[model samples]
Target: MAQRIRVGIVFGGASSEHDVSCMTAGGVSRAIDAQRFEVIGIGITPSGRWVQVAADELRDLRKQGGTLPRLSESRPTAVLLPGQAGGARVATIEGDRLTDVHDFDVAFALLHGPFGEDGTVQGLFEMLGLRYVGSGVAASANGMDKDLMKRHLAASGLPGCRFVTVTARQWSQQREQSLARIAGLGFPVFVKPARGGSSVGITKVDRVDDLEPAVLLAQKFDPKLVIEEGVANAREVEFAVLGGRGGPPRVSLPGEIVMRQAGAFYDFEAKYVSDDDAALLVPTQMDEELRQRSADVAARTFEAMGAEGLARVDLFVTADGRVLVNEINTMPGFTHISMFPSLWAVSGVGYTELISDLIDQALERPVGLR
Candidate 1:
């Protein structure tokens, strides 16, 4: 029998999206192929401690009653050390004695948001010469910052929504000027933390009066804030891209998000808490030409950012048929209900197969510069 690959599933990060990462990890722990891969759950506590999480503990963390689960620091502290044969080993430290856990053949990072998704952990993997899923350091960092991401997208000659960014220092020094720049983007704009995700610090301001407060709210998450002009009468659509080891990436069918409740965008609650807030339309009922165009743009966006393993590119399809790229999530949400997996599921790739494909791709990829 072939050796079962030891795959370390890292989750429960030190980001505002910690709970979400735990949720993603729970889904992955349940979905990964048990016959081919030996799964190890590494949970990072909110205070930034790495600990070992049991498989059943992860499985029991299912989303219930709209409450998200988080990793606690009470678990045994886990450490990753360089192995003798150009690899890494995970061990658990209990009291003063240390027990060797498992050496990872590859890592499947289920972390999201800063510290995890923003290339920090990727850099650690690279330093340890351990191959991990998702984009490399540069790509992860670039994809996490909305401002830098939009700049890269526009430089690549892609069509993206008009946006303006304001730093905390700039806002403090010249509040009026900052507001003026944002005003140019017009009303009904979205104020978001430039380096945040899961719609945690996103606020949609329909009028100029509420813009500053929204910006403040976003700044609470990060020092930099991005204000983007809302696409008029636009429908939110997403396309998933998966690849890394060989030819061009594969683009999944576009999915549409229908906001069910009035005055509710795809906010945090709408995305994970309240299922009735929105419904997904897979392979959206869009014109064939438009759907293909969106798919092509999403693939191009993924390549432009130098993303690997997988990514989800969001787009805004206006009523007039204009498809504008909204943003690209390098390490997007990966829960079963998340749009990334849902899009691929509809595109014929089951959840388990999708996880397997990502691990295979990561194993095939080299750790250093490509």
Candidate 2:
């Protein structure tokens, strides 16, 4: 008989995308193969506190609204310390006295945004010599910052929209100049927190008159900002990038997101709340050449950023058939209806298979400064 692998599915974080991360963790924990591995659930509150939360508790908190998800413990909480410490890596709680339950061979981070997805946590894993799923430091950092991501995409010879990076300092001191600079990007701009996800602090400003307020709105989410030249009446197409240790980046069939809302684009509400409202067309309605081109851009974006495990590459396809890379998420959404998982599912990889493959990638990669 073989021993089971301890897998800690880390979720929830200090980021604004905390709830979404919890949901992702729940879905991942539920789908893991019980017979093959031992699963542990860990949650970090929006206040940046880490604790071990049960799978049921995470789901329960979601059903009951307004309550900030609670953490069970803080002291000696579950930390996937390097297997060097011996015993089970998952710090288990048998009513207070921490017990090593199973040696966590790998971690599947269902975390998103800021601290979790932005390479901060990934850096910690690197220091501890622990293997974890998804992109590493460079890839995670690039994926988190919109402006940096755009530069990498263009330098890789991939098509991308026009935009300018505005630091918090510049926006604070040179307000008018920053706005004027963005005006050169044309009207109908997208103001987004350079390192945010789940549409937390994104605003689509149609006219230059409404640009300043858009900057202020995005400033609330992140200090750095990226204002993009919106593609007028363009189709939102996305592709999934899956890569492991030696696997070449594989792109899934493109998917298109149709914004049915009254606003200029898919905002916070249009993303999670109105999933049924927006039309998510799979195998995006692109000519064979354009479709292949979109996929090529996605693959290039993934490789350019040195993304590993997986990424969801989003692009804006114009009415005249030009595809522009929008952004990349190292730890993209994994919900059943989320495009990352949906595209993979339609491409012949089931949710369970997708989950397993990510873990396989983590375990295969040797954890270290490498």
Candidate 3:
């Protein structure tokens, strides 16, 4: 029999989405094929401590309770050192002894938000010459920053709503100027952390009076904030793109997000905690032509951003039939119900297959520039 591949699943971080990342890790660990791969769970605490976790523990996280699960600080500390071609790579310290763990052929990073998703971890992987899943450094960095993402998408001919990027320095020193520029975009705008996900720090403001507070709130997650003009009577649609290692990007059938809460947006609660309140309709009710267009745009966005492995492209379809590209999540949520894997599920790739395919793609792709 062929040897099983050693796969390291990394999750949790100092980001605000730490709980969500843990959930993602749980889902992935549960779905990964056991016979084909040997899995290792690595957890990063909220305080930036790295620890080793048991696969069984990671798989049972969701069954815990209402409160989110976190990586406890009590776990044994883990240190990573490159393997000599094929040997143990992880070292755990127990008193004066050092125990070496198995070497990982590939790393599946399920972390989200700033420190994890903003290319910091990806850069580390590059430095370590390790094969890891998801986008490269530049793509991850651009995907995390809304302003740069919009610019790259726009430059690639994708249309989106008008937005103003406010840095910490500008928001503090040129408060009036920043507010004035945002005002030009009109009301009913979304104030968001430039480098956040799962709608962690986002606010919808319909009046000028609420803008300042929203901006300040968003700034808590990221020093840079993006204030975007909201599309009136627009439907939120998403497309999942997957590709790498010589193949062209394949976009999944578009999906629509319908919020059950009255006048409520898809915020963090609506996405993770209270996600049952929202419905994800695969193959949106839009006309076939529009669905095709959305898929095309999503594929283009993936290629333009140089995204590898996978990405979830969100779009706003106006009532007038115009499609506006919203943003891209290079390392999107991957729970059972998360749009990235769900969309692909509807497109015929099951969750387990999806996870295995991502690992295969990472292994096939080399560590350096292509």
Alpha carbon lDDT of each predicted model: 0.87, 0.78, 0.85
Sorted by TM-score (best first), the order is 1, 3, 2
Q: How high is the lDDT of residue 163 in model 2?
A: 90
Q: Where in model 3 is the C-alpha error above 4 Å? A: 84-88, 95-97, 261-263, 275-277
Question: What's the number of clashes in each of the models?
Answer: 0, 3, 0
**lDDT of model 1, residue 267:** 93
- Candidate 2: regions farther than 4 A off: 54-80, 85-88, 92-102, 261-263, 275-277
Candidate 1 lDDT for residue 100: 56
Worst 10 residues of 1 by lDDT: 80-89
Model 1 per-residue lDDT tens digits across residues 247-285 = 888999888899986557889898767868889888688
Q: Rank all candidate structures by their lDDT, best first, as comma-separated numbers.
A: 1, 3, 2
Tens-digit per-residue lDDT, 88-162, candidate 3: 266677888767575787888888878778899888778677888889999999999998999888898888999
lDDT per residue as tens, model 2, 62-181: 424655443444544555455653122655555757675445667777888778888998887776677788999889998898888888887888888889999999988998898888
At residue 358, give the lDDT of candidate 1: 95
Model 1's alpha-carbon lDDT is 0.87
Which segments of model 1 are wrong by more than 4 Å?
64-68, 84-86, 95-97, 261-264
Residue pairs whose backbone atoms clash in candidate 3 = none
- TM per prediction: 0.94, 0.89, 0.93
